[model samples]
Target: MNIKPLFDRVVVESVQSEEKTKSGFILPSSAQEKPQTARVVAVGPGGVVDGKDVTMEVKIGDVVLYAKYSGSEFKVDGKEFTILRQSDILAIVE
Candidate 1:
């Protein structure tokens, strides 16, 4: 299945979080923090939104940081994804 976002919305897949600490101590699944970073799966076309000219700055395959509690989560073909507005994305990782 494929996802195509609309109106400046973005679809992203969460990147796997590190399971080990800097000291090489392995952390349990329950102890691992939820990854704040995600890989862009789809991007909405830039258009007028909320009466403003919104431009999309992120593209597919880009890694980005986003607000922790934003967006709606769902699953497609057994994989999880999050859909959010472009404004919720903080920064694109180089």
Candidate 2:
């Protein structure tokens, strides 16, 4: 499905939580916390800042880390996604 965000909004697909810890300890789905990292799926062209177009620092396919409580959640085609402003993103992963 194609998704286009508007005015600085970004669509992200959250990375799935790990089923096991680094030490090999298994974790149930209910015991896992939602992952705060995600990949950028779609992005708005730009946002108006003092009437000028300000482009986003991130682009589609960029993996980024964000605050745990950031963004609003929704589903598209039965898949979950998050809509967050650029400011909510903390850092881009290499």
What is the number of backbone collisions in each predicted candidate, taken in the order shown?
0, 0
How well does candidate 2 score on lDDT at residue 79?
96
Instruction: Write down the TM-score for model 1.
Output: 0.93
Tens-digit per-residue lDDT, 1-94, candidate 2:
8889988888999988779999999999889999999999999988695687778999989999998898999999999999998889999999
lDDT by residue for model 1 over 9-61, one digit each (tens)?
99999999888899999999899777789999999997999999999999999
What TM-score should be assigned to candidate 2?
0.89
lDDT of candidate 1 at residue 76, scale 0 to 100 = 98
Query: What lDDT does each candidate get?
Result: 0.94, 0.91
**How accurate locally is residue 18 in candidate 1, as Cα lDDT from 0 to 100?**
83
The lowest-lDDT stretch of 10 consecutive residues in candidate 1 is 27-36
Candidate maximizing TM-score: 1
lDDT of 1 at 10: 96
Clashing residue pairs, backbone N/CA/C < 3 A, model 2: none
